[model samples]
Target chain A: MPAPRPDGACRDEELLAAVILRLIAGLRHVAVGAQSPIPATAALLARHLGKGQPFVSLLSSARHNFFTDGGRELFDCAGQGRVDAFFLSGGQIDGAANINLVAIGDYAAPQVRFPGSFGSAYLYYVVPRVILFRLEHSRRTLVNKVDFISAPGTSPPGVYRPGGPVALVTNRCVFAFDRQRGRFRLESLHPGHTLEEVLDHTGFDFDRPERVPQTPSPSPEHLDLMRGVVAPLLAEVYPQFAATVFGFTRQEQS
Target chain B: MSAIFRSLDEALAGIGDGAMLVVPPEYGGVAMEATRALIRRGLRDLHLVTLPASSLQADLLIGAGAVATIETSAVSLGEFGPAPRFAAAVTSGKIRIKDATCPAIHAALQAAEKGVPFMPLRGLVGSDLVARRPDWRVIDNPFAARDPIVLLPAIRPDVALFHAPMADRNGNVWIGRRRELATMAHAAAKTVVTVERIHDGDLLATEASAAGVLPALYVEAVAAAPRGAWPLPLAGEYPRDEAHCAEYARLAATEEGFRRYLDRYVYARAAA
Candidate 1:
């Protein structure tokens, strides 16, 4: 077991953001939806790293969003192959990358109902790279098969799908999606977690290398940029997350 | 010509039981005061079409038993977590839910706006939403063989209701960059709105504001209701009352607690 880090070191969120930044490195545009602070952080960091090459659009932020035409423009942009990357989370995600954002049990009488599918049903097909992110890495969330397919991982041969899952980032590990095989391959385990821990908690089967590398932590420069620049920018849209993680309060921004 | 109503209730008078009411998303101006007035009026069996998605406004309407069916992509309080009343309603089968994706809702409304019978959307071919929604159809595209797409029917609502930062006496509502409000107004048969204040001059008079104005041509009525989008934020005006939203989420978790909330906020307002 890895020992807990001392104070002032890189947090788990910072590590995850670093991992996500690598996945979306060369993308032209990365758009983030509501309630995804970590992905938002990564997108912002990616923009900073790219020297303003990749435009980051936070749907909830007035400062970050460039859409003058309103919410529909996001979808329009995705359909036109303009949006390069996006993120989606699920109540239950399966091995094949199927995500269930609707209900847990029967469609008529559900045992547990999550928020209905947002843009996942559409953007998952249009956005070139859809990053599946779930902070909780547990059996209940990552199931063998989703109860409902809010958006499918892979479409049939004839389906018009320019986009699908490219990678899934969880707290425990990172898994890269293979479009041909329609499955996930464990890429790396996060710091302080083991392959056994990932296997123990995961509900679905996935391919893994014999010797998995540990996910690299954010560098000093990455930390400096995130903590100093991105944290304040993030405060405008996700005040709670900024306050909790970076101690950048909304009051400070105002 | 758009009629300027004396009160929010009067502005919403044309919307009766079973009316199809289209509303803006949470970030777009939400007509929460009008929603409370609707609850107070005891309107029932409404078919709510929340443009793409919603938060407090949809949940409150569902909790108040004002909505019989909801056609929306999702309804969750952004940070506060899942909408308790909406979750309970879905679990208990109290209201009919027509589950849709965000862009599907937008496309459907855009179809109505363009006077088109149906609109073709790119995704949702393999989604279970395709299976559930019998109204949605998958067909081989005529333009290209072996390519499949989904078509969504136009959603023409009976009334479009929302709150805005301001509206001129001529009834042009200043929505700024929130153009979805204009889309809703254009698609709906009638459009009613509550404004924070009435502008002294024409909203379309200035070239700068004209681009953001929803012309009085589409507006049926406008009423003055200060702080109309309470608990929900209106852009450039007031920020969201996070504490009140958290309180609502906590209180509305249980049936008894939800009733207490209604008595305090919804029903109590009748006297005020």
Candidate 2:
């Protein structure tokens, strides 16, 4: 791949759709949270694809209710990890890639109260592969250490571990475990973002890749499904969230 | 040959102001259409006491002043909009809050249906929640003379309004799943069933999983109302009908908007 983009070529929403479209499939139950873009889009896309295929394929079809009625059952059931893959996010994620959705301060009383760990703890235990998606890129967003470990990473890294966050899919690029150190290692940069830009936003340091790859360009098909289908669906639940997660036009910003 | 309603007003004629009612989720797959109408009526202080938080209907009632208290297990879902409002209402002391597990709530209804004193449940020992709930009695099994166990008294709701995909005049109902809503109907003093379509009258004769709905003796009304479960769904009916539920979620998101909603849609549009 050519030099990695300085600031991620694709919009975050496009990456979100592509990640979900690729990762989530063939599960009977798909659970998400109140303000989830990936799970919400996945459930809708799953249903649009076929309710019978995803949930029924898992043999959990009998218990699953795919994306009908605003995907209530799916959102409610995210922690059980009966879902094929999960989409998760947090206020601050550390160098180790541990998630923090509960709070930003001390345990007893938090300085800032985000929706205290919707199902991060449980989803960490159950879901097979979790795509941790973050929209904002700022020092505050990427922390040296998470204020709270809302969800734990694998007990042992670079090994076949079932529980814990599987990958970190963010606005910039994908980050994976540095098998030896168990710290987040920069694997690829978005098409447009550079290493300097990534470091500027990161709160902690990660070992650099000799050459970061471009996050694959979403196919026109993927973009259509994402912008046309997924974005509208997310907008319904979270009204304020207009424009794409990463595809914010100047119009949306203004 | 006729539509399911005698006119929304006549169908609603019986549900007077401050009518006490009870509803349950079939474990889940709670219906929403008919209940939405009842919700509209209740949006203005109907003295409704929800047995637990099964139906999305709880939020609508809580806003209308129909529901003064909320009783149930820890919310199964991490994020439910009405939950925040209902929780706020309870904590703010605007509504009373009570604790009951999924099993306890079901058992109570089962007891009411079986005409028993109380039903035994699997868990809830030494939980701090035990201290808060008054309706639950921790007493020795006088009959068995055994160690003390928690006894949740049967819930005999004054009226039960339920929606099914289809119901016959005789009151036989069929739904997509085997849920707990049936138990609530069995225990209630009266059951009013609204169905999406009444069918060719032989509809009640079909042997579906939920076929043994409240018998005619127990059912007082059978109005036909489709999309009963708006924000929620009735299994095998139609896919969740998201656009419809989204509209409701939008309307119910705020306290003031939800109340005004109750007034305009629930009260004004109410057939009665």
The top-ranked prediction according to lDDT is 1
Q: What DockQ do the predictions score, one after another?
A: 0.74, 0.05
lDDT of 2 by residue, B167-220 (tens): 664555544443344665677776666777765565445565334344565666
TM-scores, each model vs. reference: 0.97, 0.55
Write down the worst ten-residue block by lDDT for model 2 chain B: B73-82
* Model 2: per-residue Cα lDDT over A1-254, one tens digit each: 11223443555666655666555665655555445655566566665666445542111122233333221233234423456566668778888767775456654444553433444544454466666778787799888888766555544422223445556777787777553476777777877788889988989888877888876776766555655554554543433343435242222210
Taken over the whole model, the C-alpha lDDT of each candidate is 0.91, 0.56
By TM-score, how accurate is candidate 1? 0.97
- Candidate 2, residue A183: Cα displacement in angstroms equals 6.5
Place model 1 in a CAPRI quality band. medium
lDDT of 1 at B134: 94
In candidate 1, the second chain superimposes onto the true chain B with a TM-score of 0.97
